[model samples]
Every structure is written in C-alpha cells, then in structure tokens.
Target: MLQLEIVTPEKKIYSGPVHDVYLPGSEGEMGVLEMHAALVTSLVPGELRYTVDGKTEALAVGTGFAEVTQERVLVLTDMAAGEAEIDEAATEAAIERAQQQLDQLDHDHDLEEVAMLEAALAKSFAQLKLKGKYKGLQ
Candidate 1:
C-alpha cells in the first residue's frame, strides 16, 4: 500500500493507504502506484481518483502541488471535495459569478485578478463535471 494525504490550507482532507492514485497534472493526467518514481509536480483543477481496499474513490481538486515518492503521496491544494460534498447548484452559481466578473473586466483591470477569476471558473467547471459524473450513482 502507498500512503496518501490530501491537504488544503484549512485542514487535512484525506490520509490513508491507497492502492493507486491518479492526478490531473499540469502536463497531463498521471497515475501512481506503489514504488512509483519520486517527483514533484503541479496539479491543475480537475478530477483526482484513487483506489483503496479495492474500491475507487474520487475528488474534485483545485490547483496545487503534489509530491510523490516510493512510499507516499502528499497533495497540497487550494480545494478538495468529494462528489457528495459538491453542491451542483452552488457550483453553477459560482461559475456564473466568475463569468460575469470576467466579462466586466476592462483593459485596466489587474491581470492577476483576471487570472484568479479564470482559475476559479475552471475549478468550478471541474467540480461540476465530476459531480455530474457521479450524480446518478449517489
């Protein structure tokens, strides 16, 4: 088994031994199993899946960084939520709000602010997509 931990600034979301882990890396999606190579990589807003005890689980994660080693995987992200935890209505609302904010931006708007909003929009969309996939299973 490989130890896995997912953490955000507010709290530690998950910590346990997992059979495998899949992340949305900035470059692409990657999967990790026991004795995987040691490396650190940036993660994007997308679905994160893992297997434990022969069962698969998933989460929608915001942008962050992950550290992988032979024995452990540590993820530090801005946000992480299980399918059941995501509120589709709220997510849709957030997406609309972000889009509105982006539309309202002018030439003089702070570039950093625009980037942040874009990231937020992307994250919300990822959450919605993940939530939708498992909605019927719930």
Candidate 2:
C-alpha cells in the first residue's frame, strides 16, 4: 500500500493508504504505485484518481505541486474536491464569474490578476467536468 494525502490550504481532504494513484502532471498524466521513484512535479487543474480496496475514487484538483516517494504521495493543491462534493450549478456560476472578470481585463490590466482569473476558470471547468462524468455513476 502507498500512503496518499491530498491537502488544500483550508484542510486535509484525504489521508489514507491507497493501492495506486494517478496525477494530472504538468507534463502529462502520471501514475504512481508502490516503490515508485522519488520525485516532485507540478500538477494541473484536472482529475486525480486513486484506487483503494479494489475501488477507484476521483477528485477534481486545482493547480499545485506533488511530492512522490517510495512509500507516499503528497499533494498540495489550491483546491481539491470529490465528485460528490462538487455542485454543478455553483461551478457553472463560478466559471461565468471568472469569464466575466477575464473579459473585463484591458490592455493595461495586471498580468497577475489575469493569470489568477484564468486559473480559477480552469479549475472550475475541471470540477464541472469531473462532476458531470461521475454523476451517473453515483
């Protein structure tokens, strides 16, 4: 078993032993299993999946970093939510709000604010997609 922990600024979302983990790495999707190489990688706003007790579970994760070791995988993300935790309507509203903010940006707009808004929009879309994909399975 490999210890898997997913943490956000507000709380520790998950902490347990998992059979395997699939991360949305910046380079691409990467899978981790027991005794995998030790490494650190940046994560993208996308779906993160893990298997435990022969059952697979998923979470929508925002941009962050992950540290992988032989026995553990620790993820520190801006946002992380299980499929059931995501509210489709709320996510849609957030996407709309972020788009509006992006649209309001001018030529002289701050790059930092633009980047943040874009990240928010991306995260919202990822959450919505995961929620929609798993809605029927739930």
Candidate 3:
C-alpha cells in the first residue's frame, strides 16, 4: 500500500493508504504504486481515481501539482469534489455560464480570463463525469 493525500485549497479531501493512484498528468494519465520513482508533475482538471481494499474511489480535481515518492503521493489542487458532493444542476449551470462567456470573448479578450473560463468548463465537465451525470448537456 502507498500513502495517498489529496488536498484542495479548502480542505484535505483524503489521507490514507491506497492500493494505487491514477493521476491526470499534463502529458497523460499516470499510475503510481508502492516504491514508485520520486517525481513531480502537473495535473489538469480531470478525474482522479485510487483503489482502497479492492474498492475504487474517484474525485474530480482542478489543476494542481502532484508529488510522488517511494512511499507516498501528495496532490495539491485548487478544487476537489467527489460524486456525492457534486450538484448536477449547479454544475451544468456553471458550464453554461462559462461557455457563454467564452463565446462572447473576442480575439482581444484577456487571455487569462479566457483560460480561467475554459478551466471552469473543464472542471465542471469532470465533476459531471465523476457522477456519470452527463446527458448531452455540453
């Protein structure tokens, strides 16, 4: 087993031992096991999954960084939500709002704002996916 800790700005979502962890790496998905190599990687807004005693748990996470070591994995993200914590209607509304803002944006819009909206869309979509709640809403 490997120690896994997931933290967001607001709280520590999880802290315990897990059989394995799958991170949404910038390059791609990465799985870390016990005795894994030590490294750091960037994460995107996506789903993160881990197995604990044969049961798998998943969370929707925002952009962050992960630190892996021989015995532990630590993830620090801006946002993290589990299926039970996600509100489908609210998430959909957020997606709609972000998309509307993105659509209204022009070439001269602030690049930072555009990126933030895009990240919001991605994070909301990821939450929907965690709950299997997407119904052609995007």
Whole-structure CA lDDT of model 3? 0.92
| Candidate 1 residue-wise lDDT, 27-67, digit = tens | 99999999999999999999999998899999999999999
Estimate candidate 2's alpha-carbon lDDT, on a 0 to 1 scale: 0.94
Native-vs-model 1 lDDT? 0.94
Candidates sorted on lDDT, descending: 1, 2, 3
Candidate 1 ranges with C-alpha deviation above 4 Å: 107-109
TM-score of predicted structure 2: 0.96
Which pairs, if any, clash in model 1? none
Q: Name the runs in model 3 displaced over 4 angstroms.
A: 133-138
Candidates in order, TM-scores: namely 0.96, 0.96, 0.93
Q: lDDT by residue for model 3 over 1-138, one digit each (tens)? A: 999999998989999999999999999999999999999999998999999999888899999999999999999999999888899999999999998888888847578899888889989988988878433433
Q: For model 2, how big is the CA root-mean-square deviation?
A: 1.1
Q: What pairs collide in candidate 3? A: none
Model 3 TM: 0.93
Count of backbone clashes for each model?
0, 0, 0
